[model samples]
Target: MFGVLGPNGAGKSTVLRILMGLWHAQAGSVTFQGARLPPPYDALRAQAGVVFQRATLDDLLTARENLLASGRLYGVRGPRLNERVTELLKVAGLVDRADERVVTWSGGMKRRLELMRALLHRPKLLLMDEPTSGLDEAAFRTFWVQVSRLRMQEGLSVLVSTHRPDEAQKCDRLTVLDEGKQLVTNTTAVLSRYVGGDVVTLEVESPDVTAAVLRASLKVDARVVDNTVRIEHPEGHALIPRVFEALDRGTVKGVTLRPPSLADVFFHLTGRALSSRVSNEPEPMTIRTEGQP
Candidate 1:
């Protein structure tokens, strides 16, 4: 599994559209298996499966019917198609809901159905856009279990795009992007190469005061965001006691120290705040099945 990971408006979906032959890059071209991808994707369409960020199913159609429709679109038919659909439905844990219309299903169920529908033709490459969006931890893990099984058994190449940092951690490999530019690509184990040491985040009564005091006395670099004092230190545990000792009593309320996150890596690279929820409009991070924009 590969992930194109980034915050909102980072152009992860744009890259995916280019890869799926739905959009053209302004400058560079895309190559797969040493062959340049041309526009229209006449030959590639049949070999690639896609699960959009939104649910593409007809709510009025039964789950099984939806799969049949999608299968026929890919030229799958007869006993082979029926057998494939049945096999996928069972694998995706939707056999019980196969005959039921999707309108009554939960978000998790809809997502599972979409995944199954995407594989109706058994495309070699699967492209998922925010496949886990809106799912709780349990549902998210459940969905990935099916994906993992497919990878292990079928040797499928899955490319997924995600805004959630935790979801990106599940990728076999991922690329971090910012403002449409690629930052780095590496395995998750070594992705932290960009982040130096541990980060200690403190929620104090006065962030400015705490930051100023730390800089003036301990000479540590502290930055304030949303009334929180955040510091990254090589020896974060050692700096904790020193920070508390240097500050006046009751000046500090809480402090947490841990390894850096992908957000921290983004901040380190571009100095941009990654946690800001600027867009209420959901961009392919997950499926908003109600069709709200």
Candidate 2:
């Protein structure tokens, strides 16, 4: 799996459009599977499966009818097409609801059916834009699990574009984009090495004061985020105890040190936070009962 990651207005959608033959570029050449896609972009379009950020299925059509119609674009018909539709519906767990109108389905169900539609012709590659845009946590997990398993089973190549860092991390490799330009393309492990060290987070009573002390007295460049003082250095774990000892009695509340994440790598390279541009789904937080506070 490959990932294209960037913030809004970063030409991510344009890239997907170009790859899908939706629009032709005035300049630059596009090649797919050793075939040049210039004007008559048939070869490229013939074998590429595309899933857009939005649901494009006909709401009035039944799930089976939608797949059958989509497949016909590639000249898929007869018993072979019917068999393929049946098999794909089973894969998407929509076999029981195959005859139901898509307008009656949930967002997750439509997305799953869209995926099945994409795979109808068994294209050489799959291109997805913000594949998990509207999925809840459980639905997102289920969708990804299905895709990953399908990739292994079919030896399919998937290229996904997403603003979510955690989602991008799932790819085998990624290309980071900013301002419609490519920043870097490499394996997750190699890109993460750019950080060169670990990250330390200190939950303190006074974030600004603690951050000021770290910069002036400890000579560490610490940044304050929310109520935490975040420090990134070559050896964060070793400096944790020193930080705790230097702080006032009640100032230091908690400390954690860990290796840098993909977010750190992006920030270190781009000088901008990915979370600031994109949003992350927070895990479900439990509500406090009486006396918990």
Candidate 3:
């Protein structure tokens, strides 16, 4: 699956909406398959399924009923519709709750039902916009497990838009977007490689003193936060002994070394923390209208 990852107001939802023909881009065209997409592109719409951040199922309908309705909307009926509904229930692990009303289901269950409903038509492309929001760790794991299985089994082409780094890393490839502009597209490993090598985190009794001493002694850019000092270096392991020796008389506690992650890649690109930004501002609203797919 491909990913569109960036902070809020980065136009991820706008891009998806434009692709779905729900919103028009003034200066660009959306091409599907091998031809330019037609206005009110019914063919393209029929060949795609989109899942928004919120659940789209009717609360009064049972999970099974919801799937059947979606199938019927896509012109599926009779034995074929029933078989597809049953298969989707099994795939989403919601077979036990198939007859239960959607209002009685948990948040994760609702998300799964929405996914199953999206798959009823068996479209060529699946677009998910922040599909894992508000889910707990366990629920997130289950969702990814199902998504991975679908990709491996059906070879579905998926394009997911998310601001979470962990979620972005799960995709086969990532397309980083910022304020309606494309930044980079690469694998997680390749992006992490840009951050150089291992990161060294030193917990010192006095961060200011340790940072000063390290700067004077070593040729590295050390940033101190509270009681810790973080440094990024090509030879982090080799510098550890020297750091300890420099802080021999000082009150140093411990040291930690870790490989680069998506967080680091983001920081390198944006000069800020993702969690910090997310906490300071409200997430952008993700709206999906009916009659599109």
> Which is the winner by TM-score between candidate 2 and candidate 3?
2
lDDT string, candidate 1, 190-216, tens digits: 876677799898888889988999999
Model 3 weakest 10-residue run by lDDT = 272-281
Candidate closest to the true structure, highest TM-score: 1
TM-score of 1: 0.89
Candidate 2's residue-wise lDDT over 1-293, tens digit each? Answer: 99998877777887888878787766788877776767547786788787889899999999999999999998899999999999999999999999999998988888899998998999879899998887787788788988888788777899999888778889999998888889999998888888868889898878998999989878887887645788888988788888877787778777888898777776777766666533336654657899987
* Candidate structures ordered by TM-score, highest first: 1, 2, 3
CA-lDDT, candidates in order: 0.83, 0.84, 0.81
- Per-residue lDDT, model 2, residue 149, is 80
Q: How do all the candidates rank in terms of lDDT, highest first?
A: 2, 1, 3
In model 3, the runs with Cα more than 4 Å from the true position are 39-41, 202-217, 223-229, 244-255, 277-293
Among residues 3 or more apart in sequence or in different chains, the pairs in candidate 2 whose N, CA or C atoms overlap within 3 Å are none
Query: What's the distance in Å from true for residue 63, model 2?
Result: 0.8
Better of 1 and 3 by TM-score: 1
Clashing pairs in 1: 133-286
Superposition-based RMSD of candidate 3 using all C-alpha atoms, in angstroms: 9.6
Q: Please provide, for model 3 over 85-118, each residue's C-alpha lDDT reduced to its tens digit, 9 standing for 90 to 100.
A: 9999999988998998899788888888888788
Tell me which of candidates 1 and 2 scores higher on TM-score.
1
